[model samples]
Each structure stands twice: as structure tokens, then as C-alpha cells.
Target: MQTTFENPRYPFKHHSDLNQGTAVHHPVVIVGAGPTGLAMGLDLAMQGIPSVILDDNNTVSVGSRAICFAKRTLEILNRYRCVSPMLEKGVTWKKGKVFFQQDLVYEFDLLPEKKHKLPAFINLQQYYLEQYLVEFIDTQQQVDLRWLNRVTEVTPGVKGNRLKVETPEGSYVLTCDYMLVADGANSPIRKQLGLESRGQVFKDRFLIADVLMQAEFPTERWFWFDPPFHPNQSALLHRQADDVWRIDLQLGWDADPQREVLEANIRPRLEAMLGEDVDFQLEWASVYTFQCRKLDSFIHDRVIFLGDAAHQVSPFGARGANGAIQSVDNLGWKLASVLKQQGPTTLLKTYDIERQMAADENILNSTRATDFITPKNKISRVFRDATLQLAKDYEFARTLVNSGRLSTPARYLDSPLNTLDDEEAFDGGVAPGSAALDAPIIIGDKTSWLIDILGTRFTLLIAIDKTDISRVGESLPELLQSVGVDLVPIFLFSESTDLEVPKGAMCICDPWGYVAQRYQLEPGTCYLFRPDQVVAGRWREFTSDSLISAVNRALGFDMEVMP
Candidate 1:
């Protein structure tokens, strides 16, 4: 066996302190240039907003951490033009298998729908994702990424928040209209503000080892409970780029974290799982205790929190980075709007509402996964073993096996911004406050995706035929345009008519009615989408007054007219 450990450290760069004597003011100052921070900066830059990003380090993530990139996250990355490089380098997998001892109990597919453009999931190292984002950020002149700069102090202010930063040159003071924090789990800014996350921390620890070896195993998520190699413990295996495999072995509470990460202790575990004859190199190893915790409110006056700085969860479901990216998607547009005065300050509160809800969901799922993987008492272990045993033979028992309910985009169904259904007869599908679903469509002579056509703006998707477009053309476009909102109408052509779409809106031929079926579209139906691609409101028929009200409501305007 040939074993070696290779962990490259990121070099730190020197940055001149901009706030030496005078406080340099910026519209947005983001702390930490990790995935969340970099994504947010790119998003803001795309929206024509300038921001400064401060980071303590100068390189991408050190290890292959947070490898699973969800579809929704991929879509967000696509908006920033960062998804293609990731897809080109990532190992794509949609199938997963669960094993009890040596026998395979069940298998699952993450993405059953094939019509969508992006797959359900892709396994790419976090470092690669961050590097891709950094490349994109470098192209945008509006984004100022200052490496080797750390925020040493934070003070709240009336107009804006002030930050005292330390760099290689010296220390300086800076002020920003808004401060977005995306530091990792142990957020220094979060602690500087005397804030605390409240949640449960599991006692069990997990040893993660990244081994580089050539193997014939398919690129799929494999999990085992009480396997012969590692008895009475849970283990997970997944493939990554460079033929490096990520193996997670559950180490009981009694195991010493320091001793477990030793190469001598880890080598035998790898040999047992991959046979003694196999040659492998130890890429990286670490031991961590599971924790599910989050802040009560993500927003604090002029300061806002994003990513691990706001919430954290166990690594079982890959929720940490995915959820952080979603937070970036949610906050980017809203913050830009508020800063540009297109939206009220109250609009920022919705970020807290929506992302807190998402954080709660992640925490709940993470806690459940931790509990299932590490049963507390004898009775729980008995129930867990019984479920695993029964799942082998019975189909229904497979649902009881919880190997980390995979991460999914959270639909804000109960959001206050949603416009409830006015047409009672319409069929239910992607409703108001739900993330927009993707489908294949024909645009001109080329094939395109619905999401690709729906640019980052307020869009009205109308399912219409030739006859219905005339009626919709009467006042819909002009009314929305008058309010400075581009009503980029996407006409989903119905099969009944060869309609010529009216000017000012793009037309897509839905030959198989995939878009119509997915949206549950009725003739003349309309959907108002926010900049983040969230369904703001949907109606059975388009009315100028109704659409205006919905758009206003989505922008956080008080819809009530004063007498």
C-alpha cells in the first residue's frame, strides 16, 4: 500500500488598509470570500450594484468540502455564468443505494424528470466551485475582492455599520450602508456582535477521509449501516474529481478526535473498505461533531447575515453550502432593489423571513438525520435495526430509512408576499411563492430551456393561443412597463392554434405541452415572476389592475390606498 497525505495551504496576500485615517464608505461590504460571499458579490454585480468583499485568506477551500451541488443551486450559479465550468468538471450522479450489512436494501433516484436542463445533483468539490465563482467575480469591475483582509471589529451605527479591519499593511476603519456576513460556521463577526445560535449539538463524531485512488465503482452515493468492514457504525462513500473518494465513517462519542485523524488509524479503515491490495493516497482527513444551529433573525438593522454565518447544519445532507447559496440567491436581488430605492427598506425583512424558514427546514432535516445515524439509547437502536432489517424485504419499510433526506429548494408557500389564488377553478401546480420549475421549449429554430429565456427580471409568463394573445396584448405589457418593470412576456404557445405572438414578448412553442402541464396553465393564464425567479403571483386571466396590485405587493408596497 502506498499512502501519502497532501493538503495544500492557501497563500495570504497583502492588502493596503483603505480606512487608515478616514472611514471609506461603500454601499455594500461583504465579509468573508467563501462560496456564499463570492456568490453574493457576483449576484450583486450582475444587478449593477458595486460591492467590496473582504476575506482573511486568498485561496479556495482547502479540502473537498460540501461536494453536493443541488439543482436549484446550479440554476442560481447559471445566472452568474458559473455553472458551465462546474458541470464540465463535476462528477454527475443521480442514483444512490443504501445497504444494511452486506445486502443492498434499497436504491433511489434523485432526479426522475429528464426534461429539465440541469440535473438533480452534481458532486464537485467546494474548492472548485469557489474557484469558478472567483473567476466570474474577477471579470466584474463592480466587485472589489480584497484578499488577506479580516474584519477585526464591528460597530452598529445610525446611517450604516462601521467595521474595523486588519490587513498585512495595517488596521483601518470603514463604513458601509449594509454589511453582509458569509464567514464559516465559526463566524467571528457573528460573535463580535454578541449573537449566538441556539440548537442541539450531537455527541457522536464522524471521521471524514478523502482518499485518491482508481476504483471501478460507479459515481453514486453509497451508504452502509453496520457493515462488516466497520461494524456497529454508519459509513458513506461518494466520488469526486481527480479520482478522489470521500469516505465518512461514524466514530462514536468515545473516540478521540485527535487520534482518529492520524494516518495510521485511517489507513486500516481504508484498507478494510477497499481491500488490502489497493493502492491509495490520503488526500485529507478531519473529525467533526454534528451540529444543527441557527440565528433567530438573519437581519440586524444595517447588518445582514448569509451562509454559515446565519445558519449551520450537519454535513449528512449537504445542506450547508447549498443552503448558503440559496440564501445568496434570495438576498442578492432584494438587497440590490432596496439599495437602489426601487423597493422599501421593509423589503429586506422578507429575506429574514424566507431564509429563516429555509434554515429551520434544514435544521429539522439535519437533526433527524443525525438522530437516525446515531441512535441515543437501546430502544432507538432496536427501532433503527428493525427498520433496516424490514426494509430489505418489504417495500414500505424503505421509507423509514433516513440516510439524510437530501437537500431541496424550500418553497415559500406561506410567504406574506404571495398573492393568493383569485381564480378558484385553476389547477394547482407551481403556485405563488414557489420556485419556478424548468421545462424544455422550442424558441425559433433552436431548443431552449424555460429558465434560460426567463431573464433576471419581473416576467409575465402567459399560456396563450392566437386568439387569447390579442386580448392579453390590449394592456398587459404597457401597464407593467409604465411602472418601470419590464414585463418580459413569455408566451407558451398552445397546440390548438398557430398563433403569431404580439410584439414586445418572446414566444416559445410548447409542442408537447410540457410547460403548460408543469405550470398547470389555463388559456390566458399569467404568472408574475420576481427577479430571483420566485413565483410572485399567478392568475387564471390577466387583468391590468390585478397584475399591478400583485407586482406592487411583491415589491413590498402597502397595497392599501389611503382615503
Candidate 2:
């Protein structure tokens, strides 16, 4: 059966010149309506900040690009209430397999822990994710999404940024207090500002093809090194939604990129892998080279670069889109707070520091994966083959196999925002500046995930016995509020207790002790979380003055308080 292709409608109705003769000023202007731009706009809107998103194109992504969505990215999407559609439409998988010449070498499970709400990864076409985000943006009154609007020029001024945007009808001038340049790797804005991303570009080329076929293959990542069909090359196969299978074939530097993408050349390769009798239709194909590069700093005065505009990584680990969404998650709350005057602009500086650290980590991992996959010389090839052969027998050798390291959230251990644990000595607990892990909790006959309750603002989480709730609830809120910090206190109690909760704070039962095990809970332990759901500080026992000092430090006010 042949697969049918239905292109999404791209309406070019929102022309900026339509509102001519009026000088328009926006608080925040986001260039490009890709995942990063759309996510940032929606997150800012959720925080009561208005933004205008401009995109030269009027449609979602063209191909099934960036199909792997990590768990952290899903959590960020859940915060916008747009994850349901993705979960419904996406194919969830946690297991992956590796093969050496048609022989199964080893397999791995990404998230062995069943306690979390979301799986380790989901395979959804990028177009579907972008479509869902655009729909969510439509419901948000604070977001003004204008398609077919291209940014031609950007000038940073003392007051704000002066922008020249071109639409199909005409061009118009606009101003914004802050600008987000998410225009992608070949960012015109980055070039306009004379900025360059410094890093290495690998020589190997890869052919990515999306094939629509009905196959009995399980929904797991299948990777083959030196397969019988494609000799001395690596091939990856992954299942996506709507019977679409993403296949990536490694074509060395000498392979003609143009000839490799042709249907005549690609069909034989598909026939050799999946039998010649199997009926399939070509959905999309692209030939590209891998590069690992990133800007020295994501922030440029009033202009902030995000997503592909700041960082670029090889597609092996599925880090590009996942990392970009994380960048949006980190910047959204801080930018909103700074714009609202609730926090100093220095808070935005932390975004550059944190994300640059994340970018560097990604580049390092990607570079390692590239080197292992495509060995430059004979010695490297021998080592790679030896590791693969040994991985089939020894468990320790499996660790050395680098199909891809996979994307994990970057823990900001050295961030300035973290209030270090000076007095406490707990192992494997939720530390300051780390992303908070979720556990299952019970709330009034409803089973809920911990992350559903603790997002969007600064929160004080107290893990205490049911008997101590009233005592802590009586004074903590008032004490924290007096220091200009309005905190929402969440009380977590053990499952055995059935006690009346205090009036000021919300209560939940940690049913399976997952919270206790994960958070390293102790009596009188409390945690302070930032708006982006990263831990700001924690204390085994804290006085009012100590808590106030920690709060000030978390908001970058300690520098201001210094003599």
C-alpha cells in the first residue's frame, strides 16, 4: 500500500503592515516559531508576560526531524499543559538494541525505574510537536504569533532593540525591550550581530530517510554496526508515529551526497536491510554532515540567543531539540521575573552561565559519540570492533559501547544560584541547583505525580511527620512572606498518617516512600525550589533569618547585600 502525504496548511494572514501608521512596542519579541521560540513564548505567557513570535515560514516542520523527545523535555511541555496531545500521538519506548553483523550484541533499558510518570523517551514527529505548541499558543492571549514575518535587521539600542521585519505584503519597524534569537543554526540575527559559534565540524556524512511501511518491528531503537547489508557502516532504525520508520545510514566522506539521496540509490539499501518484498513508500530523505558547535555565551546584551542559534550537536544522541527545549525552560521564568522587576537583571546572567555549561557538556558527549562511531584510523577501528565484540559477552565492555550516550538533563552543580549545603551531609538527595525528580503522591483520593503540584513559582517543600505539619505551617509562611518572598508550602507526609492538614499549606501522602528514598527526607527538612523547578536551597533545620538569607541568595540579591 502506498502512503499518502497531507501537508499542513500555512496561512499567511497575519501581516505586520496591516497595522500600519502605528508604532508598536512589545515587551519581548521572539524570532522564529520553532520549538524553542514557541515554547519560550508560551512559557512567558504562562508567567503573565506578553511576547510576539515571528517566523518567516507559515507552517510546521517539513519532515520527521528530531523525533526523540526526552523525559525532561516532556516535563517542560507538561508545564505548558501541551504534553497530553504529544503523549497521545507519540510512540513511547524505553528499550534499545545493538547488533553486530546481524548478531545481537547487547540491549539496554533507558529508564529502569517504574516510579516516574513519563517514560525515558518518546518518538513523535517534530511536526506534530510543533503543531501542538502552535495550537497552545493560539489559546494564549499574551502570545502574538505572526507567521510569514521575517526579521531582516536587528539593532541594539540604549532603550531596547530596534527590529526590521519583512512580511509578504510589506516591511515594518518594531521595538522590544528584549529579543530572543531562535532563528536556528544558520541564524541571520547571529550573523547580523557578527557572532560566531566556535567548535569542530566532523567529516562523516549521514543519510536520514523516513520510510512509511507496516512492519512487525518492535518500538525500540535498533542500531547495527558493520551490518551484512551495509558493510563497514552504522545504521539506525527507529519507529515513529503513523507507521513511519526513521532510518539513518552512515555514508563516509567519499560518498556523493546528491547520489546517495536519490530513490534509486536508497531503495537498494532498504531492500538489503528489510527484504525486497516489503512494500514501502519514501516519505522524506536528507543528506547532512555532523557538527558540534556553540556560542561562547548565549546572552548578548538585550539580545539572547536560544536553541540552535546558540548550540548545534550531532543527531546521534537526540540532544538538539531536547536541549533547546531545556534552554527555553531555564530562560522563561528568569526572563519573566526580570521583566516584571521582581528580580534583578543579573538573574538573566545565570541563564548564560547555566546553558553554556549544558551546551559544552552536550558537545563533549556528541564529539565522543562521533569519534567512536566513525573511527579516523585503523587503530581506532580495531578498538571499536573489539569493544563491540566483547560487549556481546562481558557486561563491563557494554559500557564502552557508544552508540549514543543519550540525552540526560544537565545538573547545575556549580551554578551561583545554588545555595550550597554547608551543614548537612546527605547522599543522593535533591541538591541545590539540581532538577527535582518526581515521585507518586496521593491527594484526596487522587493519585498525582509530584511534578504536577510543584511548578511555576518558588515553593517551600517540607517533608515532616503528620504531627508536625501544624507547627511548621503556623510560622513558616508568615516568616517567608515577611522577607518579600511569597512561598507556596507543600507538606509531604508518610502514608500511614491520616491527619487534618493545616489551613495555609497543601498536603499530600507519599504512598510508597519514593519521596523519602529520593529526597533523602529527614525530620524538619525543608527545600526551596526556584520557579523553573530547580532546587534553590535546602536545610536540615533552618531559622527564619537563615531561610531569609537563602532566599535572598537564590534571587541574586546576596551580591547587592554585600558591603
Candidate 3:
């Protein structure tokens, strides 16, 4: 299996528990071996939580499925040092162009900011993503990945969830304190539990054709609506790793999905898009209809659902896998803290609450984007065409244009975990309950990104000036501990030169004032960041008592409404 980014088959190995009559117990067991499940295991491994990942197949996904991974997803994966292989193999890009009737109407840069380590998005085949996750998980002894281990039945329980896994040898009983259901859209686990994902399935089909070709096209996303190449349909062109181009052609509900994927039928379409003289090989093709749906609750006792198993969305925004990864990022720490008794079990409820909100937001956006892409009636199509036409000229109309509202991390603005800003007037910064933004920073002499410094811990980011840093950096940690709160103090300085860490505290040098500019910070500004890199609270004036209350509220310890 020592090859490039291709479909790699894994050898199934027999485990000693196969013949054991009694159920082998584990603290955590993930139901699917897809990208999110593997990542969940890796995240738990980073938290010193061992997990088992069971997959029905022994190979990376057959076709190129989620080809786009957003910056947020990359940052999460980079936490465990597994994103290097993906960044190296994936096609990195930021700009994307939207076309209407063969003319470019608008273009966008997903990440227009500088100083961030990761790109806006990378186009790597889904199989390669899974392969990279599995490869990384192989190195970690905490993750026990069993290929060809299919869960035949799931029995949810109060203490543990019982799963009957059928492997190559025989069936075995397995029990886990927590069961993460990451199985895909058609999740059998979700079905076995008599739960269903509720939402709208658009009445349209899309053909995914991964073609091997040598083309002069730049590495930008090209999406067209009613282009001359396909007459009345939408089409998309993207570059993946290894010269494999991902082409998505929209087919109305009446088209025969089975027949449209044939090489004979797809060749003419490609020739029309690319010139008739274009030489290409069809690597893979599949027809799919997207839906925006999710369960009523992600948490069902000891069994929790993650990714597609809990919710599903149209792939238009690349939110399917990206959202799943973000959920894992949110859950890994909360679950670990609960299992380790660092936080109350009620903290797990926040993951259910927060991720459901994200699922709803993604569904709402995806539903709207789908409606814009495929207008059901002629009147709707007229409005769509008019908007597209106007977008070519007017800036205001460009705002109305909805090709797809590209994926970004969900802002949990109203989350219960947030500590609302009190009477202190604040300008702009990472809002409480929203994910933290990255900026340029330096440590000692070597320059580093802000995200790399915000490790998976409760961070107390103190925006300190040169005058107060020496005193604050040395005393802040002990002061917080005396207040019965533990926080990893990261001092942000506005000076370019390296500062002496006499107390061996974490220091960030914001030479160019990027941190202050990005966070809208003053000398005394302080921000509390959760282990998931989410801002739980921030204050204009720092205080140990206030921070302790905020920390308790963030951990679901204090239910009182206090800012």
C-alpha cells in the first residue's frame, strides 16, 4: 500500500476478542471508519482517550467523494500533526469563479487574510483523506481500527451501548461507554435505533465525474449556471490532486441517473465543456441527489451521533464533511473532560446543543443554495437569471447572487456556554461562543501562527503591552490557580523583539500588531478560550473572580445568568 493518493486496500486482521463469548468493553467505540470517525479516534488519542474504529470495508472509499477541506477543518486536523500529508498531496486554492451563460460574473477568495498557516481549502479525494487519517491513527496505539468489522446490531443502554460486530472470522459482542455513530447518510445505526434524519431532499440529481486529463485550467473552482456547453443545466469544474479533475454536472429530476453516468454519455458532455479535441480518461463517475436533514438530537444516552449519521446536507457548500470535522473538534475535548471527571456530564449536553445549531445553520444555507441553483418554477428561474445578470454589473446584485455560501465555522453566538459581555463596552474581536481567528505571532526568535499556539487547552489569552507583560506573565498562572481556575496563560505582546520568559510561560510576539488588529485588543484585554479553540468569554478589565465564574459557567458548573 506504499503508493500515491489512490484507493489503497487495507488488510483485515483478526482480533483475539473474535471468539470471546463475553462482550469486550471499551471506553469509546466509533461505528464508522469514514473521515470523521478516524479523526474522532485521533482526537481522543490526543486527549489520552483510547477508541476503536469499526469499518465494514477494508479499503479507502472507492470514488472521489468530499474533495474540498476548508481551513477550519485543516486547523483541526493539524492539531494532531496529521494534516501535513493532506496539505502536501491536495490541490490548494483560494479563488473561485462563478459563471453565468459562459461569462464570469463573480469570483471569490475564501481566505483573503494573511499570516494563517492553512489555505482556504484543499481539493484532495475523500479516499486520500481517509487514508491519511487511517495512516495517522495506525501510528497511535490509542486507536484500535478494525477493518471489515461491521456492526450488525446496536443496543443503546444507560451504562453502555452493546454492539454486535460481524467480522471476517465471526460475530463478537462489544460494549463501549460511548458509541459515536459516524456512519454515512444511510446510517444503519441510526435506523436500528428507530431514529430518522428529517429534512428536504431536493428533486434534482448531480453527476460526479473524476476525469484524468492534462489541462491548462488554473487551480480555481469554476461553477457555471446555464453555460452554453450544457445548455440549461449547471456545471462545476475543480482540480484535485494528481491531475484528476472533478466535474459536477446537474441533471434535472427526469434524467436517468443510471444511463447518464455511462462513458458514452459523459464523453460528449466533457467535450462540450472542454473543446472537442480534448483528450481525457474517465476515472470514475457517480450520480447523487442531495438532502438537508438531521436527527432531533445528536446525543441519545451513551450513544452519540457525529457527522452524516446525525445530520446531512447538500454537498454544494462542502459542509458535509467539513461540518462533521468541526463537530468532532467540539466533541473530542468535551467528551474527554467528562470521562476524565474534569467537567460535569452536563458539558456533553452543550456539544449536542451547539452542533445541532450548526446543523440547522448548514441545512438552512444548503437548502437556500439548492433552491438558488435549481429553481423549481419558471418565475423563480426568471428571478435567478435576473439576479445573475445583474450580478455581472452591480455590486449589490453580486450580494444577491447565491452560487453557494461557502462553508465557514459556525458562530455559536447564542450558545449557553458563552459568558455575555457585561457593561464594559467592546469594539470587535472573537465573539464569545465563536471560533478564534488566527494571526501572525512569534515565540522567542522563530515566528509562528496564533493557531499553533492555541493548543487544545483552556487558554487565557492576555493581550499585554511591553510595560505589564513581565509582571503579568509571571503572576497570571498562579493568580488564576489561586482563584480555583486553571488556564494556560498565553501572553500576547505588541513588541517585535523577543521577551524573556523568566517563569517559562507561553508568550506570543505580535510584532506587526496583527493580534491587536484582529482581536481589537487593548493592553488589559483578556479572552478565555475553550479546549476546542472557541472563545468562551472576554473582558476589557481582567479579574480572577470574574474569570472563575466564567470558567465555571463554561464548564456547565454555574447555571446562574451572570456575565
Candidate 4:
């Protein structure tokens, strides 16, 4: 299939004919339109940034790869104003169940003793999630999504980057200010960039099938090890929205082929759990091995890799897409700040620092999950099964057993981006809530603190007396506006008692609230926060000169913006 282009302009300016290479220019070019790319697009679009999203596939994938959605991801989507419809369709799970030798041994509820604006987890089909995001992107005036276009070659240009993309029509060249590579596990962009990735690919394979069942399996997730149906294998089942159940079977590495496994392998296990008479239709099925790895660097010159392009993790805890979207949430605001020139381009380096920490956390959790499911050898397997069985009787053991190392925002206390003075001032320490990073704090009268404000802009939690506001009010707003910085200033009173309130701390909440800068209230003191929400500079012992300098440093301003 060959096509011709006489001449194209603007977005396709660098395009050549299918056979002849022409050049097209786009401010931002993304390689894949999976959750990460679509998310990055939404983040940029919210800031009114123009970008182009391209995917190799012509249509959305029918296979349900990632079915579990985390609380953190739902929060990021809420920022773009798309979560309403999705929450309507997603199934919320309040608890999870674990079994050993057909005995119900462990049960844990995510909402046991806490209050939160969002549920801990929701089960939604990946296809529908993608549909919602893609639709949202289509509605954005700043976005152009091109499907069925595959990149055959990417050449780093002198100033920017050049990409040769192949399509059903033909091949064209695309020059971009930055290339956000959200392409999946077998990312060609990561390979083309020559970034080294090292990890272990397990020899074992698992058969996964999504089925619609009529039987009454509780909404909670269920898993069985060494069941009568398949004595040596592991069977895990999860209930999804609309009575759909995602089932996975550990089939060792060299188990039966796909056809035989689908036709003859799964019924026995299904019968063991749902009774022999239960009926269900298979939605999708596949066999694949789990992998763990990370890229040597997320940023290589003008191209920044995201999602699976940067790292690959097992599907054990549904970390792949969820973690990737979190990475997007972390990088989006920083990129926007750099583009607007409100912050130094050097601030872009912090994207690597912060997101790389996130990647490391994901890798650790993912590896722990992978090891828990697939032990290395016979001795490891025995130890895992014995520990799980022993956990049935002891409370301490059960906590460790059911915990699964789940997922949480990585702590950024040790980063150089953090202000040393804030750490000393916080009686609670430099981390967000000081609750061992278990759950994010909720603001007073606000339905959300973690998800709603995240992935949008920088936030300033101003702790000041109402009487003294006039002093800071004169120059604070003007300084923020001059730097093109989006600032959210929240006022806290001295006598406020809300635990969720930021307290005597004047803090900065970035798109992701992993770290908040704290300052003990001084009558006139104010702090400037970077787009990443780390403190760029502080105005403690406040003076007009000192405050202006902090603002300058926060915005990376060499010279003050003249009034």
C-alpha cells in the first residue's frame, strides 16, 4: 500500500511521499497512544499546549491487558475532567480474598479503617479506559492524534529530533521539539535511542482469560493455590465491572499451546471455583511470560521515554500501566514549566530524578510481586506456600501476607530538590503526610487532595494570618503572574484544627503531592514552589528583597520581571 503527498504544511511540513522522505514539524510528538501517551497528551492539553499523538495500531486493542486501576491513577484522570464517566463504568472493589489449598485463608479490605474521597481500587477494562482518554484528547483543541502511523526511523536532529514514520499511505519525516515515547514493552524508540535495559524474563508462562460469568462470586478478588482442579498450578480470579471476571492460570513455562489451553485447560479450574454448572463466555485469552527491567536513562537528549518504553514490570499487581501513568503525571508539569520558560530548562532534569525514583519503587514492588507468585525453585516455592499458610493464624504474619507490597507514592525526602530548612521545621518530617506514606491527606471541605489537584499545576499552601495578608498580598500575586507560574494559594489560620489542614506549615503541592515543602509561619514569610512541587526557594525571615530573590530562583529568573 503506497500513497503520495504533493506538498504538506505545518504539522506535516516535514512529510515526504511514501517513497520519498519529506519533513513535518510538530511542537511535541508522542510515539504511542496507550494510557501513558494519551495521559501525557491530556496533561499538555490542559495547559493549552499543542501536541501530536501517533500510534502504530489502527484501532483500539480488544484484549484486556491491564484490568486493575489504582486510586492514584483515578486521581490523575480527575484533573483532566474525565473521571466522572469512567467512575460510572468502573467496578469498585472494597476488599480482596486469598485462598490456600481451596481454604479461605486471608481476606483484606482496602477501606478497613480510613476515610478517603476515592476507592482504593477499581476494575475497568483497559479498552474502555483508552476509549475515554482518546475521546477526551479528540475534544481538546490543542491535540492531533494520528493513528495507523508507525515510526520506522528516528534521527536526533541538530536542534530537535527527526522521525520517519511509516503509514498505510506512505512514509513522512516529523521534526519535534521533544519526543515523548510512550510506546509499549517492545518499544522501538527506546531501542533506537540505544538506552541499555537489563532485567530477567521468567521462563514460566500464564494463561489469562476474561470471562463473563453468571455465578455469584463475591466482588472481592479470589486466588487459589494447589487446588483440586489444577493441583500444581495457581489460579487467580478477579471480578470486573458488569459481572466480568479476569482469570489467570500459572501453566509453567512449557505448558499446553494456546488452543488446547483455552479449549481444555481452563474449565476444570473454573469448575473448582464457580461449580461445574456455571457458564461464562470468554472475552479474551493469551499466554505470556512476565518481565522486569528498567532503562539506563529516561531522558536521552531531546527524547524522553515514558511507560513501558522506560521500564517493564510484571502484571502481577497491575503495575505496568498504572505505574506508567503515574510517571506521566510526574513529568507533564515539569515539561510544561520548561516550555513556558517559567522555569529553567535545567528543571527538566528533575523529571528524570523524580520519575526515576518512581520507576525504582515500581521495580521493587513488581519484583516482590513476581517473586511472591512465581518462586525461583522448589525450596523458594515451599517457603512461599508455607509462609502464606502460616499467615492464616497469626495477625502479624497475615499483615505481611496480605500486604503484597501493593503500591504507594515513593518518598522524596532525600532528593536535593527538597529544602533543608523545611525538613528541620516540620515536626512531622519532610514527607507529605508523615503517616508512614500509607495514605494521602484530605483537605478541609475538599472532596479530594491527592487526585483532584494532581497532574494539573503547582500549588502553594499559604499559612498566614488574615490581618497580615495585606503585606504579602502586594507583591506575591504579581511575582507569580510575572513568571507565568500557575499557583494555587490556600490560606490557613493559626488556630485551625483540621488534621487534614496543612497545619503551621506553608507548603507547595506539585501536580503530584509526593513531597510538600514546609515552613514555620512568620508574619511575612512566603515560599515559592517549582512546577514539580518541590520548593525552588524560600522566603523565610521575609523581606521584600529576600522574597523577590526566592521568586526569581523558583522561576529560574536571572533578571526580575520589571513592573
Ten-residue stretch with the least lDDT total in model 2 = 1-10
TM-score of each model, in listed order:
0.95, 0.96, 0.96, 0.82
Writing each residue's lDDT as its tens digit, candidate 1 over 193-274 gives 9999888889999999989899999999999999999999999999998788899999899999999999999999989999
Point out the worst 10-residue segment of candidate 4 by lDDT: 1-10
- Per-residue lDDT for 403-465 in model 3, tens only? 778889989887888888963467677789888898878888888888886747788888877
The true-versus-predicted C-alpha distance at residue 128 of model 1, in Å, is: 0.6
- Candidate 4 residue runs with Cα over 4 Å from true position: 1-22, 113-115, 257-261, 402-404, 421-424, 429-455, 481-484, 493-563
Ranking by TM-score: 2, 3, 1, 4
For candidate 2, report its TM-score: 0.96
How much is the lDDT of residue 295 in candidate 3? Answer: 94
Q: Return the lDDT, model 2, position 146.
A: 92
- Candidates 1 and 4: which is better by lDDT? 1
Candidate 4: clashing pairs of residues: 13-23, 14-22, 14-23, 14-24, 15-22, 15-23, 15-24, 16-22
| Least accurate 10 contiguous residues by lDDT in model 1 | 1-10
Candidate that beats the other on TM-score, 2 or 4, i.e. the better one: 2
Error of 4 at 442 (Å): 12
CA error at residue 291 for candidate 4, angstroms? 0.3
